[model samples]
Target: METNEDKQAFEPKVVAFLCNWCSYAGADSAGISRLKSPANILPIRVMCSGRVSPEMILRAFRSGADGVMVLGCHIGDCHYIDANHRTVKRVTLLQNLLGYTGINPDRLVLDWVSSSEGPKFAKVTRKFVEKVRELGPMAEEMGKSLPASKINVLVEEVTG
Candidate 1:
C-alpha cells in the first residue's frame, strides 16, 4: 500500500541551464533566501542562455532527464543586449521539433528571471517540477518510439 508520502516522493530529474548574469544569480538568491524550490532540478550555468544549444537539450533528454529548463534574462534586458533573441527562437523551434518527433514539448520550458527575483525562481521551479511530475518519467517517453515514416518525412523536409 502506497501512502500519500510515497506518492508525493516521486521526484523527476530536471536539467536546468541558467544564465550567469541573471538566472544563475536568481538561483543563488533563492538559495540565500531559503525559498521553497523543488530539489529535482540540476542546474548548469552558462554565460548566457543564448549558448544553450539544441544538441545540449537533446542530450539531456537522451541522458534521462525527465524535464529540461532554460532560464535567461528578459528580452531587451540581456546583459549582452539582444543575445536572448536566439535563445527565444531556438527554444521555440526546439519545442516544435520535439513535438514533431513525438516527444512532449512540455518536457522543456524556457523562462526569464532577473537576479532579484528569488521568489519567482522558487515559484517557477516548483511549477515546472509539478508539471513534469504529472507528465511522469522519461522512461515512459523512451518506451514509445516514433514511426520510421515520420522520421523519414522530417528528414526529407529538412534536407530539402
Candidate 2:
C-alpha cells in the first residue's frame, strides 16, 4: 500500500533555461562556492533568455519536466542589451497559455540572477524545487492528454 509519506517523497524534475552570460555563470559560481542547490535542476544554457520560445518550454513539459525556470540577467543588465525584457513578456504570456492548457502556471517561473549572485541562485533553485515537490508528479496532474482538436482550438484562440 502506498502511504502519503511515499507520495510526499516524490522528487520533481526541473528544467532550467539559463542565460549564457549571467544565469549560467551564476549557477557555475554556486557550484564553485559549494552552495547547495537542488540536484533536481537540469540546466540548459542559452545565449539569452529571450531565445527560449514558448515551443521550447512546451517541449520541456511534454518531455517530462515537472517545472521549468528561465533565469537571466537583471533588468538593464542583460549583455545583449534589453533582451531579457522580451523574456519577461514571453514568460508572462506563456504562463497564461499554460493555465489555459490545464497546467498550473506556477509550474513555470522566470527570475533574474546575475553572475555574482551565487547565493541567490542556490536559494532560488532550492525554493523552486520545494515548490514543485509540493505540487506532486506531473504525470498525475496530466493524466489525460488534451485531444489534438482541443489543442488546435487553443492555438487559434491564442494566435487569432
Candidate 3:
C-alpha cells in the first residue's frame, strides 16, 4: 500500500539531451562553477541536437520521464553547421504529434545554449523542473492517452 508520504515523495524525473559541443560543456561548467540547479535532471550528452531522434524523446516519456529538454548550440552557430536546424524541425513536429495525442506538449523543451552560457543552462533547467512539477506525475496519464500497445499500433501503421 502507498502512503501519503510516498506519494508526496514523488519527485518528477527530467531527462536532458545536451549537445556535446555546447550544452554538455555548459553543464560541466555549471558544476565547476557550483551553480545550483534542480537535482531532478538526468543529463544525457549527445554529439549534436541533430542527433536526437523522435524515438529517443518518446522513449524518455515512456520510460517515466516527467519532462525532457534538448539543448544545443545557438541557431546558425552549430558546431556541425546548421545541425540545430534539423533539431528544430524534428522537435516541432514531435510537439505537434504529442498535442494531437492529448499529451501536454509543454513537457518537452528545445533551447540554444553556448558553452559560455552556464548560467542560462542552469536557469533553463530550473524552469523546466518547475514546469514539470506543476504537471504532476506523468504516470497519471499512462494507459489513458499513450500506451505501449497504442504506440506499437501507431508505429506499425506509419511504417506499414
Candidate 4:
C-alpha cells in the first residue's frame, strides 16, 4: 500500500515545448538570472509554437511525459506575426482530444511568455510542475487499457 508520504514524493515528468524567439529565450534568461524553476521540465526549443503539431504533443505523452507545456510569445508579440494564434487553436483542440482519449486534458498546458519575461517563465513552469505532481503519474491516469504498447498500436493503425 502507498502512503501519503509516497504520494507526496511523486515527481512527474514534464516536457515543455518553447518557441525559439520568445519562450525559449525567456527560460534561458530565467536560468541566467538565477530565477528558480522546476527541474522536472524537459525543455525542447522549436522555431514557433505554431509548428508544434498534435502528433508531437501525443508522442511526448506516449514517451512517458506526465505533462506537456507549449509556451510561446504573447499575443501580437510573435516574431512570426500571428503564429501563436494558431498555437492557441491547436492546443485547445488537442486538449479536447486528450480528454476524449481518457487522458486528463489538464496534463497539457499552453501559455505565453515573451523573451523579456523570465520571471513569468519561471513562475509558469513551477506552477505547471506542481500541478502535474498533484495529478500523479500519466500511467495512473491511463490505466492498463491504454498502455504504451497499445497506444503505439493505435497510432500505427490510425496513421497507416
The TM-scores, one per candidate, come to 0.85, 0.87, 0.84, 0.87
| lDDT, model 4 | 0.93
- Measured with C-alpha atoms, the lDDT of residue 43 in candidate 2 is 96
Name the TM-score of candidate 4: 0.87
> Cα lDDT of all candidates, in order?
0.93, 0.93, 0.91, 0.93
Off by over 4 Å in 4: 144-160
Positional deviation of residue 157's Cα in model 1 after best superposition, in angstroms: 17
For 57-154, candidate 1 gives per-residue lDDT tens digits of: 99999898999999999898899999999999999999999999788999999999999999999999999999999887788666866667677887
lDDT of 3 by residue, 39-63 (tens): 9999999999999999999999989
> Clashing pairs in model 3?
none
lDDT of 2 by residue, 69-140 (tens): 999999999999998999999999999998997889999999999999999999999999999998888888
Give the better candidate number (3 or 4) by lDDT: 4
- Candidates 1 and 2: which is better by lDDT? 2
Better of 3 and 4 by TM-score: 4
Model 1 lDDT vs. the true structure? 0.93
Cα RMSDs, all models: 4.8, 5.1, 5.6, 5.8
| Model 3's TM-score against the true structure | 0.84
| Clashes by residue pair, model 4 | none
TM-score (C-alpha) between model 2 and the true structure:
0.87
Which RMSD does model 3 reach against the true structure? 5.6
